[model samples]
Target: MANEIFICHNCPMTRTMATIGTKWKPIIIYTIGLKQQRFGLIHAKMGLISKKILTEQLKELEEDGIVKREAFREMPPRVEYTLTDKGLELLPILNLLTEWNSRHHQADFK
Candidate 1:
């Protein structure tokens, strides 16, 4: 155990961070958490995000078993993003953090 020196080959925290620590992932999670949304809706809420970042974040979340992506075969094709059971579980965590920030750092912010 002493020689382990905290190796991080596929560690859980590393994996969690890899999935949610990016600037876009939490925003994407929060956006989709409100309700299932199409690509445009998420993009509209986060106007500053580029298409490349949105695409990357969605793909990562889907691959990480957090977000679900669905596509419809309409005339122009339709797509939607939603949180999975795992993804939905993150909401309470985010909300708690929000409450904590409000209590502790409200003055630090406006």
Candidate 2:
């Protein structure tokens, strides 16, 4: 008799968490989902996140294929960040999380 041990290499939940499992990633995604495409706009909306950290997060998101960054050449350089299909797919999940938080922590708002 031969005994074989099988191990699951990739877990969907782990992969998903590794992608957007940060204090800022989801908020950044939600802000982008709201149509704020420019860096300044996203930064302004997030108010508390430092520019360095925001830039870093955006870069990571872009590298992970969740966000797309477009740069335009002209007198002033313009760059905009938008959700890729993968990022768009994450919107509903974020929405559900938002709804859950609101329902359970309604008192926090007051």
Clashes of each: 0, 0
Which ten residues in a row are the worst by lDDT in model 2? Answer: 1-10
What is the C-alpha local distance difference test score of each model?
Answer: 0.88, 0.89
Instruction: Report the error of model 2 at residue 54, Å.
Output: 0.7
Cα deviation of 25, candidate 2, in Å: 0.5
CA lDDT for candidate 1: 0.88
RMSD of 2: 3.8
Which candidate gets the maximum lDDT versus the true structure?
Answer: 2
TM-score of model 1 (CA atoms): 0.85
Candidate 2 residue-wise lDDT, 1-110, digit = tens: 12322222356666777889999999999999946388988999999999999999999999999999988796678789999999999999999999999887987777
Candidate 1 lDDT for residue 57: 88
Residue runs of model 1 more than 4 Å from their true location after superposition: 1-4, 7-11
Quote model 2's TM-score.
Answer: 0.85
